[model samples]
Target: MRFDFEGKTALVTGAASGIGRAIALELGASGALVVISDLDAEACRSVVEEIAANGGNACVFAADVSDEDAMREAVEFAQRKGGDLHMAVNNAGIGGPSVPTGEYPAADWRRVIDINLNGVFYGMRWQIPALLRAGGGSIVNMSSILGSVGFAKAAPYVAAKHGLLGLTRTAAMEYAQQGVRVNAVGPAFINTPLLSANLSPETLEALAVMHPMGRIGTPEEVSGLTCFLLSNRASFITGSYHLVDGGYTAP
Candidate 1:
């Protein structure tokens, strides 16, 4: 069955580009009033403009997910734009400190925890109460295959993503009876611009070979599963982590 979010309101973080931007646009196109946010003010507005140009409902807010005040304001801005809050995608994050834990710089470690882990937490901390007031909603936290398993040189990121699962599960349990659902989407080697910061041709080939499907993934691929989890189609699917990886975890 097709999932439709007609008349719903959604707020997506890190929506300036990549997976976050795609998710925001897709949700808007699906009949939801969308509020797109990013750390970059201009980029966030640009994405919102693009969404509007495509005949979707959207507005933009600039905020750093790591900043408690900024995230709070973003949600407030979304509510003012949409007139209500029904859903949110806590997708703002960064892969920080790719070295061994012992050697990982303290500054880098803090940055990863601040954005990757703490930022998600902040988003949820503020969003949950808002969702409750709006009669409950769904929240999708962006995770990665790294959330389930591990890889070399990504200790901080792996640790943070793992912690996110624990948070998602706990929140889902706590809110299951409250008309709210919390879930996660864990993708593997999705070809988003984020990859440009790390993966090169050689590494891309290695990643493609690593997945049992013999291919990487796309942001839209992840968004498809995410939208499902956000809609009523996944009403009974809270507290679960859905992997959108190309069978990378399978033996």
Candidate 2:
């Protein structure tokens, strides 16, 4: 599971928890100095501490991904700390209201699209230049099973995720010859706080049954693929969506 990122640097949004945290830790362990980013400074620092305790280099930069200026600053901040930006994982996002499409709040929809879709764009807008400055790099945009399939009561999230594929593909095509690689990672229901806190046991069980694997995936599992995509091991891979979805979309 280890890849050589020695002397390289990476910026990971939503690194304070869940799949993002796992990717940050793995990237650090693989020898890359990590920039841990999230909305909460304290939580970001906690992840930094964990990386440091494990003999990995990391720093915290708190920023709301929905803000374009903040995201740009975050990329700049990481470059200042690490001397270059070789990788970026745009993993920050939010789950909008659980109500059905008819009842879904307009404000909530905008908030979700802003964070999940616009946030990725903002992250890449700055990250691409940073990578170019470093001569080349990689990016992994976090998508979801909902990106490829319909999910009840999750109109905004679904739309935003689907949008990511288009963005990822176009960015890949535009930057492929320029040495930057762009791709998306779609995970099924993960055993993260986001899902556990929002769903009842009955609902969770129902979701598990929807997957061919009959179980939810762990954050580490998704992180493994993410790190691989960021590594030179996947140098020929870009503009594609890799599913860590327990075969949820196979049907």
Candidate 3:
């Protein structure tokens, strides 16, 4: 669907690459003054340049989503740079060590939960208020197919993604009447840098077959759903989960 975000401002976390980067670019191209955020300053700047090159407005905000204070500062940075915070995409996450739940490394589990689950809460903590101040806005929290189903050797990631659904729903209910809309997006394994870094080609191919579509998805595919949710076109959509999983969960 076509969307115009003129005069709007959006903050996207984990926007250095992958799905987050796609979302940032989509919003920017649609006319929103976008704030690109991630852990790496250089990577975030690169996204900013890409947005600018497309004749779209964007800026970089480097911050660790796992850090509560840093998350708040990131939101504030968007407000200062873009004049308002009308939309937010909390997409920062990590896949922990691949080990069975019983043998999962405690540290890795904590770290995954910190970034995937807690980071989203931190983003909402700051983002919700800013959205309210902007006279209401929208939020899209990135979940996964794992949010609904279990995955072997990914206990932490599964658990964290599941937790995001509850958070998204609660926040949506609380603010549904107040103006802000909150929702979660669940994607099956997409061909992102993180997936490439962690999985071998053979493993990825095997995983691709797990989806009925016989292939993996892409960042732009997920971004299409995300930007739709962020726009007025989805005014009635909130406090729910939408899947772009290539029928991965059809079973």
Which prediction has more favorable lDDT, 1 or 2? 2
TM-score against truth, every candidate: 0.96, 0.98, 0.98
Residue runs of model 2 more than 4 Å from their true location after superposition: none
The lDDT, on a scale of 0 to 1, for candidate 3 is 0.95
How far is 249's C-alpha from truth in model 3 (Å)? 0.6
What is the C-alpha lDDT profile of model 2 across 215-237, one tens digit per residue? 99999999999999999999999
Q: For model 1, what is the C-alpha lDDT against the true structure?
A: 0.88
Tell me the lDDT of candidate 2. 0.95
1-251: candidate 1 lDDT, tens digit per residue: 35688888898998888899889878977889888888887988888888888888888788889899988887788788777789999998887756887798989988988998999999998889889988989999999899999889988899899999999999999999999999999999888888866778888888899999998898889888889999998889999999988889987
Candidate models: Cα lDDT each: 0.88, 0.95, 0.95
